[model samples]
Target: MTDRIATFPDWQTKPTVSPVQGDLVYPGWLAGSWSMSSTLVEMVAPLAPEVTTPGFEGNRQFLNQPVVCQVRFLPANVVERNKAILPLLSLPTQSLVNAQIVSDRAFNGLNLAKAYLGDRVFRVWIDPRDSNRLITKFRDNRKLFSTATGRTVEQPDVDHFITTELFQQFFQSPEKPYKNQVETTTAYTHQPDNTVTADQFTAVYLQPPHPKAFLAGDRPVALYHYQLKFVQQGVR
Candidate 1:
């Protein structure tokens, strides 16, 4: 029975895993705040303009103005989305930290002085190699299914000259849990003319169950690419 007792003790004394920590600092190019505006120019032929959908007008023009952008360091306790590191964090037993939110118009530059952009906040993290290659993450909790789920944010590489972004638009729907899911990535480069040029993704809309969802679709959606400019009004 002594051997059995010894085995029990070893099982009880197993070591617990700890969370991974990081102290990624924000870069200088992102030190100041930024304002973002986008115009959605959809496809003409494949979009089925005659579908009679208000939001799905073929070659439709949609505008989003003055979206705020910021760059900053993430807290040490926050874990990078490393699958290998997750098990080490003891996440199954402990709850993850809540994502921070920033909604002030001054911070977001949102004209929400009149209204607001749901819940506006973003957190940034640094890749261990070079701090210059920083990740910009965005989140809006109001888009979550419930307060429990919180908002989903993604990390994308961004630098002073160019950046890559990947994200989805979230919404609550009656037929399904979420609606109008979009996954997109655009390449942005700073121009010599003091404006930024977006090599926006040419493939826009993909059919349901998305790539992240691990489901297949009828065909890969195509994007209509364009060169939109970003100009800082007050910069001297």
Candidate 2:
């Protein structure tokens, strides 16, 4: 049996170009402080043997419970210069850059018990190799280790933009209870109310033989669908 880890799309070898010099533009719309409400709408365990099995029933607890969070996007300089290593290597230091900071009373809704999950900071940059793609690196935090790659679909004529991000998350310590990968797709539409409504869907995957797996082999463990709405409050 092969013991190799799963391979994801490579971001390191992707060409890097100065943001302004390429079609790959930083997502300017994401800049600003906003209040976000995220609701888990659906959950499914694809590989489970019985559709109505008790193992999957626990997912219902998250349905329709909206968790609120404070999300802020700041200029890259807001982050310490020492933390800017990844983005600085490919993009011009003087160019416009963005970093996202997220905090939630419900631990960003990941914890239903409303535990305190420390603030998460993320740096965003255009993929030098693909203009249609963007890469984000989550800074070191006490909670988790994650990296995400996203692809954008823009319809400038209709003012609609959608970005789908694939995220890989690993427990900081091997003893941590669970570890999984998630994909979230968010759609943005400009509303007449001067607010952008975002709808998101997230799917969770776990390798078989994983500590938290319901089945005994490698495959998807669960899928979670979420709806999120963002209302801009002010500039960060």
Candidate 3:
């Protein structure tokens, strides 16, 4: 994981992985509500004119653009659950100390999707019992189902963390179901000033349903790198 961060966008292959079964734990420092911003710093089309993935061209407009949202990391003991699936779980300040931290995926996912996709996103729900599966509903009658198939995590020190997750996206619509693979690797650091920053790299791959899947093999057709900043906002 350390080597992957040092290499950055030159990543030649996918990161190592293991089956994703439960919630991904984080370092103690990350347990709090945060106001975050993600800016696209760079992008690359590895396969280029030969094999371009969907959205590769459309994403160019996002270069240097930042998406702002509210996100949180919480301890397992305080996360809220209900039949409503609202995901607006409350975070008690007193309970966040020295606890096992985990990402609030459903809440974070919905905020993130809307930040980028705008008002087109209707809602996002993650299976309450399983963090790996999530369904997204869009206002245009489009739906997206995603499953985290594999992941890898490393904490080399008390303040730094590195992780990679591999997932498959199944887009459902009247025309057909579009399938693809996505890999995201991120390195996060807790700064002395009580803020957090991360370097994130994302790659999009073509699946068998796509005509160039065989030719591309494991190479990513589209690659994107982002810079993220998080400041504690004391619960949204």
Best-fitting candidate, scored by lDDT: 3
Q: Candidate 2's residue-wise lDDT over 1-236, tens digit each?
A: 00110121111111111222212222555445567777877676665653222335765766898777655444444432322322223434233333432121112233322322223534344344543333333355324444453333444445466544555555554344345655555566667765667666555655433655554233444555667777876433
For all candidates, the clash counts are: 4, 5, 0
RMSD (Cα, Å) of model 2: 11.2
lDDT of 2 at 121: 36
Q: Write the per-residue lDDT of candidate 1 for residues 1-236, one digit (tens) a residue.
A: 22322232122111121221222233223221234444443343242332221243434433232333331112223334431222222332122223321222122222321122344534333335632233333363222211111122222434333222222334433445442223223445555664554544333233344432222132223334334445543221
In order of lDDT, best first, we have: 3, 2, 1
Worst 10 residues of 3 by lDDT: 80-89
TM-score comparison, 1 vs 3, better candidate: 3
In TM-score terms, which candidate is top? 3
lDDT per model vs. reference: 0.31, 0.45, 0.83
Which TM-score value belongs to model 2?
0.54
Model 1, position 65: C-alpha lDDT score:
29
Comparing 1 and 2 on TM-score, the stronger one: 2
- Candidate 2: worst 10 consecutive residues by lDDT? 1-10
List model 3 lDDT by residue over 139-199, tens digit each. 9889998889999999888888999999999899888779998999999999998899999
Instruction: Score residue 26 of candidate 3 by CA lDDT.
Output: 86
**How many clashes would you count in candidate 1?**
4
